[model samples]
Target: MSKTRQHCFDFGVPPALTLLLGLWGITRNNSMWRDEAATWEAAHRTIPEIWSLLGRIDMVHGLYYLFMHGVFTVFGDRLYCLRLPSLLAMACATALLTLLGSRLVDASTGLATGLAFALLPAVQQYAQEGRPYALVTACEVLACWLLVTAVDASNWCHWAAYGTTVLVAALLNWFSLLILFAHAATIALARTPRAVIARWALSASCAVLGSLPLVMASQAQSGQVSWIPPVGLGTTLNLLMTVVMGALGAYLARTRLASGSVRVSLSALALPLLALPPLLLLAVSLTRPLYQTRYVLFSQIGLALLIGAACHALASRFRRQPRRSIVLAAAVALVALLPIEVPLRSAGSRVDDVLSTADNVAAVRKPGDAVLYIPAARRDTALVSPGAFTGTRDLALIENPRQSNTLQGVEGTPEYIRKAMLTARRIIVVTDDNTSPPASARDRTKEQVLRSHFIRRYETRERGRKIVVYVRRADDRAATPTSRCPCFVRKGSTPTPPGVVPTEQSKSNRTQ
Candidate 1:
């Protein structure tokens, strides 16, 4: 008897449903990452505080906050539910890309475009993340569709849609302004006559100028910031690869040569037009202060479209040289994909890993035991208290009176060493090897401060997250060293200074 072969359901479902299912799977088990945890806290602001909060910390994502205010009303702020909106937004983007690809290029191109976006690693990563990236992606496709439609004619409605879309896109993420530059550059390469190009350019220029006020406000609020160094040939090539062939963006120059259609090539070039200008500016900023990879994501649209074109152009290679194209695309896609999914899976897997670790370590009620954050790593695998491992009540349950205003990443956080040591039944501070002096220095002075000053209890490392528990020896209790005591400030500053209390924290702030 012949085995019954199962056909994939993606073939039968409408693009819209397939798109949603794909996004849902990507987002399904992704526990909220740290930055996303922060966003959830901010977006659920009360109506009275919403306006003030939007202007203060979040100038660009104001419109999204307003939408999330609606999300909070129904979903009531669970992490998965809060992130549901972003996944839905990404699904909309996949559907729109399919329609746009089909309408702008051809049916096969359109079908592939939707499928490509649906499976793309970057799209998958952001769809799972609990932030505004998916929403921005959605706005990007809609804006591009609107702009392309408007350029085809002077349809007043399309132009109006273009304006509204531009404003909403900008509000979702300020970098959406880069779309204007992409449009300008693409129009120049368009086979459209110079007269027509000039007319379209003028129209787009007006639309961008109209958005100047909001853009200027955002710029002033953010202040000029940059850290990325000048992008060399290597970085440029890497970015180009990521933009054009989905994960193929990693090996841009290495990929096989293909003859891209004029439409596709022009579209591909739009990516550099959108991203390169800002990237170059960021490179120049390396000398002064401002570049973060995340801010420039809106530019990836040009890259994504370009990659779709490249994929379409090069896909036939897979048919002829089945071994070559399949092998190359597979290897590149796998390498590019690991950096995202692997990390996500590792982090998610730790939910159980941390729980298992908790089972073995009995909570020893030693009086000096404290929950110390050794050297204070930038992040930890799990945030919840280790039930048996720490032998103390979870800080979440602790009546932390001052948590209301405890800003994340503030300089003074690790200063709680002294207090945690004195109070915790089994004191344990977690840290990685980050704080040790360079090997050349071999500073025993600093090393002694840790070993002699703080009594070591237990140390463990699993999958890069480290936990080191220390106890304040009974003799050391009399010393009352400021380093390990609560309210005991680090040498330079007091833990709770005179005027540092919360100004007017509400009930919501207490929950954090």
Candidate 2:
């Protein structure tokens, strides 16, 4: 080999290599996702009492948000700050995978494992998210180190560490336990042995016992699982296939250039690739809960391991025939992944569009004008959060102001025109609505509900968001600068939402 080639062959420093790899994957896709918007909202919280406010949301990843608070504090909350934690956590996950693989197999296997993990679009997407997926990936891999140790030594500390991993994984996202179940099932099959298994079981029980306090909190607070669209068998299978096959394709791409390696690769890949997916599918099915591809990120390492195994199996198959495993793997990955990445990224684009419109809405708030927001259908916070006018207190979120602020839900049919004509001041009505009622007040069409209620007075198009401001009248000063406004703008630092009681904010006599 040439000297330059030989120099390139030398493995670089581990941490930097992981950092560079993670950065590449994260930046490869820049689209935002729905959950990411929520993270951005949480990370940009402003009230001193935001921690209390955040607790009400039932998001399982409180620790992730706290760290994000610190990041936003320094970096001045923006997309990068929202995304940086996931990026760094992916780097850490890669390093941990390398460590775990090296111990289980060898240096070559470890490097191959890391390389495969780096190319996965799923990993890249989550790694750039503002949520907890990447960090959970890191913890899952680290737990493996302790699990392997506990298998042999049966020591208290090792067992304790293994259990601690279980606790952390469960707390971050309950679905994380799905991966734990997969690993536990694999252990129970006598693949390793009986006596060692018994020891691991006892250790696991202790971990569960220790975690009872935290888990109970979840159980006590657990409301009825939210409504989920019925998932067919096809969707369930496709989700599994995508996670498994997509990961394998990424691994194959990473290791296609390898010359000779079988044992090192297969062992490293077997545990993750073959074990995690089906088990997770079964778990979700039992609960009848909604299942999306990203929720399984906690078990992604297992998928990487599976890909490593596939890499060896393919390489060996091709070795004798000399056909085209590397070429085939590359072809398959691009075909399977590129198509899916487009739509997934499209969903992310929609999320960005939502935020952009929010910025547009914020830019147009006139400081004291009545801010009328008719949430055409459901009360989605994303649409409303941006309506908050960038952290100011001068806006009132009005549903129907033509009626008295003291008036609650209307009972009798006074009619839509009466409601429309009651506002006699300068006001802004914004709706991406779908509410349809008889006696159409604004009448754009059948599909367009709120379009009929008010006439467009001011429209601002900026940041991918369209703020179509409407009003009943052109002259009334509808709001005061001292009233509370929705919080939809970027923050100057990391913050949390204020925990102002809804009742207090809604009191009829409190407004100016």
Candidate 3:
């Protein structure tokens, strides 16, 4: 193969494959989980509304929300529009990784590295998500590539670009700042020259300084991530496996390349990139619960690089039989990954499907019915599918999400909530299926009121969500068979209470 054709194959194949994988079942059967619902709600809001929302919560995702607002404006607010940017960003990340591998090692290693990255479960998962992590991952790779280039040439422009890219990634998610620690470890391991090290320090410092405002602003909203659990046995095992795999691959590739052959050795770069950020995040999580694997999604790049290097080493070892060996390895990997890949594109794959919950709500709701969102964040279901809740009142809500510039909207106090619940004959409660204790005093209060004041009449579980109907104990006994309420009563269903009338308007509205 000619150099140009080889270069094209190396750079082109991985990203194209990534795009293909991303586009396959991109909608997840038309389901939008709560997290994606948050993105959709935020992006659909006016620009000023998004800005106002950032002031109160999710400041870290401000830039991404704004970017998506533009995307929605241009392409219209379809699921395709919501997730396409992430797909394209992952594709770009794949291309950048290919370039990084080619520049640092051989073309074969670059091709393998890019292909590995594209096929990674984490990468594939995020690539199809509507969130900003994939974009952050792309920026992280671009910054890494620029760092390699800057180290080689020691140019101001390269350092500036690296700093700017880091800033952008941090703006997308402040946790991405953890990558700087990994980069520092890479420079130290490579025994970079004093001048280049100084330049790196300056660039990194500038990036941090640029991101300081978001850091400070996001601290006030730390409660948003208060739900993140502390690292545990499962997390430890996953991290251990990741590190072991990278180390084994690094060991395999060590003999094939001289440390002095490249300005920064691939092992030096890939090892810390794989291991440090997640380890550091988990370490901090010990004192303050802040660890979530998705936060360090960029670390997958390191693993992919190591895998590529390992493949290159194996190819070198079996020069005459390289094709057969590579084909066998690829087949084993694909077969192993097939089960996971198939489910990832399914509606039930995510924690909770907001659209499914909305459909359930629409099916059972009547015009004058009241609704409650336990833990409140489940209000995202209503936010994304407002039509499902057309005539229902949010009994505990003080203001709607957009009006309050909050993700879940502000809620009334416990006393107010209790008083409001007393007025409703039938209430719909949307909550998770898990029996875990409520996360907040408000949620506990909601649960307590439901248990004490209302009788659980009907309940159904769908896609990790539970929609339960609670009828007031006083109204439950005054039931008539003539009422057409769908609260699934086993023998004699609870009828609409006197003065609480069901209207054709609600029925017609739900149909629309």
Candidate 4:
């Protein structure tokens, strides 16, 4: 093959495979989890509304939301449209990583690195998600590739590209700024020329300055991640294991490579990239919780590179049959990852299925039924599937989501909500299966009122969501079983006529 064709072949295959893997079961059975529902809700809003929402919350995701708004405008709102950007972004990241690996090691190693990245469970999970993490990962890999080129050539144009890419990545998610420390460590460990270090410092400084505004603005929205748990023993053990694996890979690669064989040392680049971001985030989380694995999804690129180096080293040991050794290794990896890859494409893989919850609500809903979302954020279910809630009233909502410029619409005050609940003859409650107490006083009031005055007539749990039908307790006969309540009719059964209540035995017989 010609040199150009060889380069194309080396870089093309892994990304093509990655794209195919991402496209496999891309819709997750048309289930949009809460996080993706947040994206869907924001993307469908008008630009002005999105801007208004950013001023109050999610300013960190402001740029991504605007980008996705444009996407939705061009493509129309659909599950594939919501997630295709992430899938494409991940493929781009895989391609860039392949190019970077080829520069740092050899074409064979580069191919291996790209293929390893495509198989990572985290990469697969986020690639099919409708979120910014995959985009952030792509930008970070592109920035790293530009950084390596800039360091090699010491050219102003390359440095400028590196700085611009870093700025874009940080804007997508400020946590991506952590990649800078990894890059700096690579330069320092490699003992690069002072001129190159100077150029890198200038480029990195400019990028940081450009991202300062977002960094500052995102602080105001920091409370959004308050739910992230503090660092624990399990987290520490996982980080330790990751570090051990990277170190082992680096050791193997160093023993195999001769000096001057590659422009950038694979160990210098991959180890820091794999280890620094998550380690630093975990250290910070010790004081104030900020660590979430998704925030540093780009680190997987580092792991992929290290795996590539380790595989290259091991394959070299089979000097008489290196090609067979590589084939065997690839087959083993594919077999090991198959089980994980299959489940990731399933709807049950996510925390909750918004579509399933919405479908259940739509099937059992009756005219004039008041709907309540416990903890309020569960309103996302209705927002993402508005048709399912068309005939019902949102009893606690003081303003609709778009009107309030919030993901969840503004809710009435506790007293107002209590009064609204009192007026409803039948209510539908949509909530999660979390057993924790309500986080806010308003949520507490909602639970208190429901427990005191309403009785659950019918309830079903599906994919971590709880949907319940409740009817007002009869004032004269508080001991009446919910089976006799008008709203207690089983799904697909004839509804009891208005002002007529079925006897418990009659309802039981009918259900049987």
Flag regions of model 1 displaced more than 4 Å: 1-30, 49-58, 191-234, 240-285, 288-293, 310-452, 460-465, 475-512
Model 4 clash number: 0
| Candidate 4 lDDT over residue span 143-246, tens digit each | 98898788788899999999999999989998999999999999998789999899899999999999999889878888899988998999889988988998
Ranking by lDDT: 3, 4, 2, 1
Those runs of model 3 whose alpha carbons end farther than 4 Å from true positions after fitting are 321-328, 439-441, 478-512
Question: 222-260, model 2: which lDDT tens digit per residue?
Answer: 552353445677876766675667456546544442332
Q: How do the residues 324-354 of candidate 3 rate in per-residue lDDT, one tens digit apiece?
A: 4544565577679989988999988998888
Instruction: Sort all candidates by TM-score, best to worst.
Output: 4, 3, 2, 1
| Backbone Cα, N, C clashes tallied per candidate | 26, 18, 0, 0
* lDDT for each candidate structure: 0.49, 0.50, 0.86, 0.84
State the displacement of the C-alpha of residue 264, model 4, in Å, after optimal TM-score superposition: 2.3
Q: Estimate the overall C-alpha local distance difference test score of candidate 3.
A: 0.86
What is the model-wide C-alpha lDDT for candidate 1? 0.49
Provide C-alpha RMSD values for all models, in order: 10.1, 10.7, 4.3, 5.5
Candidate 2 residue runs with Cα over 4 Å from true position? 1-34, 43-51, 74-76, 190-195, 219-227, 240-287, 316-354, 362-368, 372-453, 456-466, 473-512
TM-scores of all candidate predictions against the true structure = 0.64, 0.66, 0.91, 0.92
Off by over 4 Å in 4: 1-6, 259-262, 319-324, 475-512
Tens digits of per-residue lDDT for model 1, 1-512:
12222112222222454355444444334344435544554565665565665454456666676777788788776655666777778777767766665456543444445555655656656666567878877887887777666666646677677667766666677666666666666565555565556555665666577666667777756632322345566666666555444435324422322232333232544455446645654665556534445555556555545454455556654475332343355347646766665555333432223322222123222332334333222122223212343334332123221132221222222233333233544444444434554231112322343565565444444323344544446644643444534332122211232212312211222111
Best by lDDT: 3
